[model samples]
Target: MKLVVAYIRHEAFEPIRLELLELGFPSITIIEVKGSGRQKGITEQYRGSALTNYLRPKIKIECVVADGDTQTIVDTILKHARTGSIGDGKVFVIPVEQAYRIRTGESGEETLQIHPDAAAAAT
Candidate 1:
């Protein structure tokens, strides 16, 4: 399985989540986060004065899915999150050695029962 981590602009969270659900990725975790990229935060004008922007608010969406669905998931996130500007955010994929559904004691890929084809496609 692969873990897809997406850090996106806060405003785009709801839209991205809806898009993900439409693409069959509904089991996800969303969290509020703060960070900056190459541009390093941003500067804004307040009351006719420039205010230093050190950290920006962002949303982090995480989900584990079948490897075969990796490309689709990434594409979906990028398509929905792009703003044609800086701080649109980024996506990261990592291998997940294990997972578990605490309620049922289901483990590993079984935890991600949402994607039924993951195991079959893995081999």
Candidate 2:
């Protein structure tokens, strides 16, 4: 298994979420975060004074998927999150040595996807 983590421009989250869903990746964790990257934040004017905020707001999207699904998931994030500019954010693929679905006590790849029965029930 692998964990795909992406810190994306906040505006990019919605579209990214939709595409990932269309690609059959329905389970992901979303976190509102703030960080600095190569772009290093922006300077703005307030009360005629320049203010520089070093931390920019971002949306953190995390998903654990089967090993074979890693690249496709990363591509989906890249396709939607790229703005062709700095601070479009970063995507990291990390090794997931294990996973366990707490509610169902399921482990391995079985814990990564919404079971067919559970999905149908939600619909």
Candidate 3:
């Protein structure tokens, strides 16, 4: 299995989410995160005071899928998230040793599948 983690601009979340759903990948974990990359951070003016090196707000989207789906998921995120600008974000693909669904006790690749019938069966 592979875990795909994408750090994207806040504005890109909705589009990327919709695209992922359309691509048959609806199970995702989203987190609000703050960090800096090559752009190092940005400076902003707040109440006539310059705020330097402020961490930018980003949406972290995490999905665990079968290894074969890694590239497709990454491409889907990129297709919807890229804005042709700096701070667009980054995607990291990591190996997942295992995954478990607490309610159904599904594990591994089965935990990543989205078939309603399979879910019902698991229960």
Candidate 4:
């Protein structure tokens, strides 16, 4: 299994989620995060005054999927999250050692069976 972690522009969350669902990769967890890369955060203008904020608001989306589904999910996130500018965010795919559903005691692949997309798609 692979764990896909993506830090994306806050505004791109909805589209990414919808696209992931359409691509049959819907199981995900999202969190509000703040961080920066090369360009760092950005400047904001308020009341005719400009303020530089180094920590930008971003959305972190995490999903665990079969190894084969890694690329597709990464591409989907990149496609929708790109803004042709710095600080667009990044995606990381990590190997998942194991997983288990606490409620049902389902482990490994069975843990993912509860995911509608994973269950519907015959990967």
Lowest-scoring 10 consecutive residues by lDDT in candidate 2? 110-119
**Candidate 2 deviation (Cα RMSD):** 1.2
Question: Across residues 1-123, which tens digit of lDDT does each residue of candidate 4 receive?
Answer: 999999998888999999988887658999999886787757899999998899888899999988887899999899899998888888999999999988767788767655556458866
Residue pairs that clash (backbone atoms under 3 angstroms), model 1: none
- Worst lDDT run of 10 residues, candidate 1, spans 110-119
lDDT of 1 at 66: 85
> Which model, 2 or 3, shows the larger lDDT?
2
Full candidate order by TM-score, most accurate first? 2, 3, 4, 1
Model 3: worst 10 consecutive residues (lDDT sum): 113-122
What tens digits encode model 1's per-residue C-alpha lDDT throughout 1-123? 999999998888887789888887888999998887875956799999998787888899998998888898898889889998988898999998888887667887767765445547856
Taking the tens digit of each residue's C-alpha lDDT, what string does model 2 give over 36-101? 979985999999999999999999999999999999999999998998999999999999999998
| Candidate with the greatest TM-score versus the true structure | 2
Model 2 segments more than 4 A misplaced: none
Local error of candidate 3 at residue 48 (angstroms): 3.1
lDDT of 3 by residue, 1-123 (tens): 999999999889998889888888989999999998787857789999988875888999999989999999999889889889989999999999998988888888988877587669969
By the lDDT metric, which is better: model 3 or model 4? 3
- Error in Å for residue 34 of model 1: 0.9
lDDT per prediction? 0.84, 0.92, 0.89, 0.86
